[model samples]
Target: MARLADYFIVVGYDHEKPGSGEGLGKIIQRFPQKDWDDTPFPQGIELFCQPGGWQLSRERKQPTFFVVVLTDIDSDRHYCSCLTFYEAEINLQGTKKEEIEGEAKVSGLIQPAEVFAPKSLVLVSRLYYPEIFRACLGLIYTVYVDSLNVSLESLIANLCACLVPAAGGSQKLFSLGAGDRQLIQTPLHDSLPITGTSVALLFQQLGMSFLPFSMSSCRSL
Candidate 1:
């Protein structure tokens, strides 16, 4: 069976640190590490993941999301990363950075947002088309933010599953667990058609009345 995504990473800002070094942010969680290829990710990812670090200005809003593309020299495989940035008000009282790292090491769960810093949830894949993932990021994030039923781990799984076609006769679906569950439909293959109505629905899901031409303009492209 073809896999939807190669890696799912949750990167959060480390408030204790001043620079965007290796310790600048913590890799909160990653899925299916055993199946990872020989190439190491997120090693040079700091440069693209958090471009200018966290912003302290309340007047200027930071960009919510962006995409990163790079070629793996060793494997000669092209990779696309869809990073969705978000800021949440997290209450962390006396939670040491070391403790948070320890908890993640032990339970693979992000205990709390590092000192109320912003977070970037990244989805990396070999999918030829990056625009499809970028288009879906907002809707996916909106659903993720609004729903309390989905956890970070499950959200990754759901995102992975969304990249594959729904299970039917002769189609062997990728399984994250023992039982089967419903998944959101997100385009994966290039042949899949996207309609304007679907685009409108995606915008609707994101609570946007109309498309913002400033950020995304056909003329710019």
Candidate 2:
């Protein structure tokens, strides 16, 4: 398993198949996010796969990306201000972080209350560059698969992520198991490679470990 970091990212091509770009318009999808204590919320946030946030800066020229990092306010995972989503204050540019966070209550993007905000933000780009998009989605897939989920939907997403390739047609994918297990892809199996693993193995390996699933905090990937 990868070490927990301040931020984690995974990239992949939403294109249903490898190489060829199809289902491009399905980029915008809603993630069935959850809250602390694991409760489903109806007004789930919307993810803009190709939002302007993809644009990269001079130091990193890739895409214009926005800033959003949602944490479980009730859990210790709340690393920083949960109001960071206020960075979307499109009307104000070059503003102070404190100002934006302070004014978030009335921003209308979310509720004036902190707990009403969505779980996280989704970054997306176009399929014009099929390879690039696939690489991006593949990166996100790695983190999405490895981490434990906070809800059933997240678990389902993790399961589906296994079949998701590095690109639409790319053979690369991630494998998950106990810390003791090794990662090796077997083309004969044509699936995520693991050392004869199973659900029991994962619990056995992860159970004794000091790292709790909540320690992973908010994952941007």
User: Clashes per prediction?
Assistant: 0, 26
For model 2, the superposed segments whose C-alpha errors exceed 4 Å read 1-28, 31-62, 76-134, 138-221
Question: What lDDT tens digits, residue by residue, belong to model 1 across residues 105-177?
Answer: 5433345543335667676765533545554454456556677454546656766654454222122233333
User: In model 1, which regions exceed 4 Å deviation?
Assistant: 18-23, 38-42, 59-63, 88-116, 161-221
**Estimated TM-score for each candidate:** 0.51, 0.20
Say which candidate scores most in lDDT.
1
lDDT of 1: 0.52
How does candidate 2 fare on TM-score? Answer: 0.20
Error of 1 at 8 (Å): 1.0
Q: What would the per-residue lDDT of candidate 2 be over residues 86-199, giving only the tens digit for each residue?
A: 111122223333326554643334223211111222422111222323333333434443563434344335423333322222234443322112222322222322333344
lDDT (Cα, 0-100) at 2 in candidate 2? 16
Q: Best by TM-score, which number?
A: 1
